[model samples]
Target: MNKYLLTIFTLFIAMSGFAESPDSTEIAIKEIEQSLQYQTGTIKLKEGHGTLIVPKGFHFLDQEQSKYVLSDLWGNPEDNTIIGMLFPIHVGVLDDHSWGFTISYDPMGYVKDDDANTINYDDLLASNKKDILAENQERLNSGYGTIELIGWASTPYYDSNKKVLHWAKEIKFDGDSANTLNYNLRVLGREGIYLVNAVASMDELPEVNKNLDQLIASVQFDNGYKYEDYTDGDQIASWTVGGLVAGKILAKTGFFAAILKFWKIIAVGIAGGFSFLWKKIRGRNENDTIEAPTKPIQEENDEDSTKS
Candidate 1:
């Protein structure tokens, strides 16, 4: 971690030519690394929902740490809805090649799986592409780069017995040389769905896809909240298997709002995140917005896309 900080700081100094206080840089880096507090073993989910048995070669950061990584390290706006994050042991959260699964649970209630087997993922993919095209004008109007839905890296698959749905999408942001990967997992519970989203570049698709099953097996709802525990009059989710597969996107604000989230990836790697780090290391006013350091844009994100 110290090495990573040093490397980034060295690059920061070289790029900006600011021989700023090394003491401050070292301290901030130490604080940020310590803030991660990555752990393994059994992790009890909040609200008695379930447990995450973090596998070997991986680490889990609880809500506070996850929020810090997302908002601070990743240069994203603060989002408290996230439950945690899962990362492999090999990479620091700040690594340019870093990728992780963000975990957030939505108590949207029991989602019936009657349509699980019937969903035509190819049709859904076509619809998603059209939606992206339809929304590109608004994105251009908003002075943001248009997003291209390149189709599924992994087609949607739902396991009715386990009440789980998962899929992956390959997306391209305007002007970017590389594409982004959005891998989603929905584990239905008696009262809600657990949303696990993998954020990475398409370069990591093989790795993310390889571990999908293991990651899926790690999260399990506690006894009463298990899928089979649904009762006669319990709350029900409006989404079905298809909706879960279409998780982060909507016909409405989905892709537009997701811009706030995905653009951070631009800053973190493609655009050089040194400015965000410099400000954090040097300290800043509380009211200042944490943006992706890319283009200046609106802050609305896919809160509904993730939590609702």
Candidate 2:
């Protein structure tokens, strides 16, 4: 009877310990969230470009944390192309499954809008698929999975009045279980363009589109930086709306292929990174917090203004 009771007590203890593990994990997540100090409200963009009015249901991660999340957590190269990040308010900072948007600016000079209504999207899509197919070999050689452009999740639409070009692509990364939805928003300006790229699963495209209008409305250029402010002497970007949709601009930025690899990491992070971060955070003292770093958003660039 004593041996049986001891065995029963040991099993009970084991069960209790297992039950407590989840609670501990939850606590760790909460702590990490608190430490991150995620901000909300209007976040001013670098170089007097504009301000991002972070929507009511989202929070903004500043430049430093954004870079860390992309480079360290998401396994992308440490590039200054990232200006900041927009995260859903309901999700934890480390929650990878939830969709978030990365903001970047390309000072590739004024992008002319002459091709707004003239280009054929069907032809453009065909050309883009060929370009992607040709690039797949390089991606494979580099150890990144190849991608297939399934179709446009959301057709290209330009708001000429707002100078905002928005489109979405349905992409399948080789070996990925679910298709990826790449939503692109280009906010044209006098000096360059602001790129808002949202990476999410195809299933979440509807949810992403639902918030598109609000997100587009939230960004505005400062005075004298609007597209209408462009002068005849101002430099023009080598590409146009059609090229933008075709990923030509991204290719010049040298981020096109890296983006493919980056998204893979994002998928893995969402699927598994949270628990890993939870474990790391749990090892730290409960009282510890990751103080938000104060860093300027602008980084130095020496590239010619005419290049895109």
Candidate 3:
């Protein structure tokens, strides 16, 4: 009787192992492939300010679906400030590796570039580190992980010709094994700034920087909204380049905390997400289905059509 019971237990363990095999997981994933969808091409920004020319090897997620991914799927708090998202063309919403970056507009008034030439990034980084330390308790109290600024992955670079400011930071979050790469691009405009915040693992900095120039060039402000269009009566942003780099604007706009909390999820997800999407995208001619354009026109109320 004891031998019979032991044999039954061994059989149950064997069956359980088979049930959880990788092949079964793959079969389940394939079954839901038809329901999974992704969007690419041009994505119009809020208030008809401009359009992000979603590059050839990328896709865009509209505001609502983007919010869901950030808040529900990735476990970040809901952020209404996010206007849209840019994802690699190969990845879908369910992919676990990475989701790419978010696009947000801050109508904080025109920022002056007077201080761009003289600001010291080393000092700015030190100041930012102090600020992070000061805010860590607040983050802990809010149920989020504390972050340490490991230093700049890429120092601030501003293009006066294009009115674009770009920077990258290496950050370490509590309990996370990998460091987070926070790449920021701010396009100054007549009314405010267009922000592209891309978070990924530190290892992806090269890939992220390689695409940064093209992405920055793709964002075009409307005719009357360019940085040069700012008039005498237009409101001026209270902060300048130094303030922006020191995380003053980020703190004021409530993005500093959100970014810190979300990088942990991004670090874990990007590798798997990129790999899985690459496989799916390589399986088909995705470019043949989506129109790749230099500057695409905005479609009225087109956000709903792109929903998966």
Backbone clashes per model, in order? 0, 0, 7
Against the hidden true structure, what lDDT does model 3 obtain? 0.60
Give the alpha carbon lDDT tens digit for every residue of 185-296 in model 1.
8888999888888867888889997888789899999999999998999998887777766544532233211222332222333234365554543243344454423322
User: Could you tell me the TM-score of candidate 2?
Assistant: 0.73
Q: How close is candidate 3 to the true structure, as a TM-score?
A: 0.72
lDDT by residue for model 3 (1-308), tens = 11222232344344443343444444434433343355766656774388778877777777876765554334454567778787776654445445477787777788899999999988988887887687666655554556677888999998989999988778776666677777788888988888787746676577787788778977788899999998999999876866677653222123221232332222232223323322332333244443211111111110110010
Give the whole-model CA lDDT for all candidates, comma-separated. Answer: 0.65, 0.62, 0.60
Sorting all predicted structures by TM-score, with the top scorer first, yields 1, 2, 3
| Decreasing lDDT order of the candidates | 1, 2, 3
Per-candidate TM-scores read 0.75, 0.73, 0.72
lDDT (10s digit) by residue, model 2, range 1-308: 11222232344444443333444544544564676658887878875389999987988988877765554334344457777888788865445465678787887788878888987889878876786677666555544456687888888998999999988777776666677777788888998888887756777678788888899998889888899998889989886766677654221222221232333322233233333333332334345344212221111111212000
| Model 2 collision count | 0
